[model samples]
Target: MLKEFKKHCDSTSLSAVCTQLTELSNQAFCVNNGNIPKWQSALDDVQNTQPGKLSFKPPYIAIDTKADVSGLTRSLKKLMPWRKGPYQIGALQLNSEWRGDMKWDRVKNHLRPLNGKTVLDVGCGNGYFTYLMSLAGAKIALGVEPFLLFNYQFQAIRSLIKEPIKAFVLPLKLEQLPAQPLFDTVFSMGVLYHQKDHKLHLQQLMDVMKNDAELVLETLIIDQQHGDQIIPEDRYARMRNVWRLPSTNTLQSWLEAAGFKHIKLVDVTKTTPEEQRATHWIGDNTQSIKDFLDPENNNLTIEGLPAPKRAIFICQK
Candidate 1:
């Protein structure tokens, strides 16, 4: 992944962020190719691991994600996991990764609203959004992703930049991403639903960012409450596609608890519906989950379903 990042940064022009790799990132920048017992188990839920399994095993990478860049490709060049392409940034990406880019014109403004401003991107997959931030003119945009593959991938992209674009890779969890609260804005999108502990995750993110810092949140939300959530037998690291979509009241309360004074729902894409769904954009993704996510396409009404409404919750610390 580090190699890929280096190549990407070299291709672009942001080498500053990755001048030095953290010790932890250096440790995780490689992949262990041999498959472990747990590796086979985690893949298909065939053989599950013990509830408290904490030991590291072979096959350092797991989860078949469609990341534009793959760290697994570094050690073993022959193993090319099916590549998907023609990526497009839409309502979801805009709400999440592109949220900080308040205005649209990327060329004119450089999308760098927080120029000379410290920034942190939690759950930054593939670091594509991080790239956008750099283009926008952010002084520094450090991305944090726990996935071994993604963590190194971000590091790799940083390594290549010609001009310095500050980024760091720390395997630390959201709850453990340092407590300095130095950033001016912390952005997280499509990340809250993936956390096993939603409340704690919320607390952790808020803790890392500075007071009066902007918290841009984008996640799947249900229009109405359902009695129960559909739990997947074995989902993404025990997380859900659509976990807790805290009601506007619940989210408002949590932000307040996290020392956020202003909480507002900036936009609701469901009103338009078509442009936002990944099916319209991520055609590769739709091949598997057909019909895509058009609520109008199908009369489906279940809370937290795949096609649940998505909203952006902006909070000021």
Candidate 2:
């Protein structure tokens, strides 16, 4: 993956960041994650499978391969808790916890054409959207994910494909990246609320963006009726990392304060069970948005805060 990334960087304006990126990826992938052995074993299974034709078939990011379905299922289950996809491998539908295509549908038509553009997908779980970006003709779609398991999952999928698209997921965080203006388009989806300092997060996002580059910002937001924002008293939806859920107006202001221009609030939709559900792929401890919300009142979380409503803001840096 690092070698492929270098080849990609060498071919574009991103060459300046190549060495630094390589170093960061090396350091990240080397970390001692106890689960590495199991993850690697699963990746081995993916690698052994016959090469497949990859395509975005609406709800599925499918690979048309002639492989033993039962064996493949067993192999994939080893890397369980599939969080970000609904992929089709041969005839088996690896239905993940999140129907990522639905999120793509809400944002795709609104995006600037990706053809020939250098793109970044921050917190890209297993690089699902990264593959879609590359398929959309991005010059190169670089996905940075800190979670080591997710990086391995990405490699597993990449190994199954016959042709390598210009998409690569590296085990690195946005903060670890050099503050270089490289990407033509940047996506910070489902990441901001996790930041303790939202302003710094926005600033870091701006730092890597080329002049006039577009940013597609997606994060949990409270309704304007809930006042400016909600600093979660504890947990928003049973997840501990969440920090702030800003109003759409508050989010727009933050973008303006970060020196972004032409900020546009493109979409605001509540999360639904259809998009995020408990699946066999999520493993034994299956829980989802449905479990996080109040059974008595769908509009409120179990913690009694505003339910999970996400807002998408597109702006220029």
Candidate 3:
């Protein structure tokens, strides 16, 4: 994957940072993760199957090709807890925990055209949206995911495709990328709340984008009645890494403070079970959004905080 990424980078604006990006990705891949062997084995199994063409099949990143459904399912299950997609391969349906298409529908039409654009997807789990960006005709869609498992999952999906798409997922974080104003469109979906310092996160996003580049920011948010923000004392919606939930107004202000222009809060939707639910594809821990909410009140999390309501803000750097 890095080889392909390097080749693609060499012919584009990313040429200047290709070597550094590949080296960092190599270091990340080399990190001792006990699950690597199992993940690699699963990836190898999928690669042996009949390759297919990838396309959007409504709620799925569909791959059209025949394969031993039972064997394919078993191999994919080895890389369990698929979180970001509900992909369809051949006759098999990998119904992941999150129906990512719902979120995609909310933001897709509002963004700038991606045709021939250099795009970046931060915190992209298994490159679900990255594939969408490439399918939308991006010159190259680079997805940076720090989680090693997701990278392996991405490779598993990529291996099954008959033809290579202009999308690639690397095992690196936003901070690891070179501070080059390169990407024309940058997406930071479901990532902002995880940062310890939201301002720094916004700043880092701004640093990597070209002037006038579009940024599609999506993260958990509170209603204006909840005040400017809420710093959770503990877990929010059963997610420990969530640092804070800001109001839409506050989020817009943060974008402005970071020097963004033409900021617009495009969509604000409260999460529902239909969008995030327990599915067999998620493996042993089938708990999902419904499990995280208070049994008596859907509007509150089990921890007595505001329920999961995400806001998508479109702006320019």
* Most lDDT-accurate candidate: 3
What does candidate 1 score in Cα RMSD to the true structure? Answer: 12.1
Write one digit per residue (lDDT tens) for candidate 1, span 104-171.
Answer: 12122212267666777787665655555554556666677666544443433333333444444455
- Mark the regions of model 2 whose C-alpha exceeds 4 Å error after superposition: none
In model 1, the runs with Cα more than 4 Å from the true position are 1-21, 30-112, 152-162, 167-172, 225-242, 271-306
lDDT of 2 by residue, 92-186 (tens): 89999999999999899999999999999999999999999999999999999998888888898888888877999988899988888989999
Q: TM-score for every candidate vs. truth?
A: 0.59, 0.98, 0.99
Better of 1 and 2 by lDDT: 2
Q: Candidate 3: deviation at residue 225, Å?
A: 0.7
Clash number by candidate, in order: 16, 0, 0
Which parts of model 3 have CA positions greater than 4 angstroms off?
none
Candidate 3 — which pairs collide? none
Ranking by TM-score: 3, 2, 1
Q: Name the top TM-score candidate.
A: 3
lDDT of 2 at 76: 88
Q: Give Cα distance to truth, residue 244, candidate 2, Å.
A: 0.7
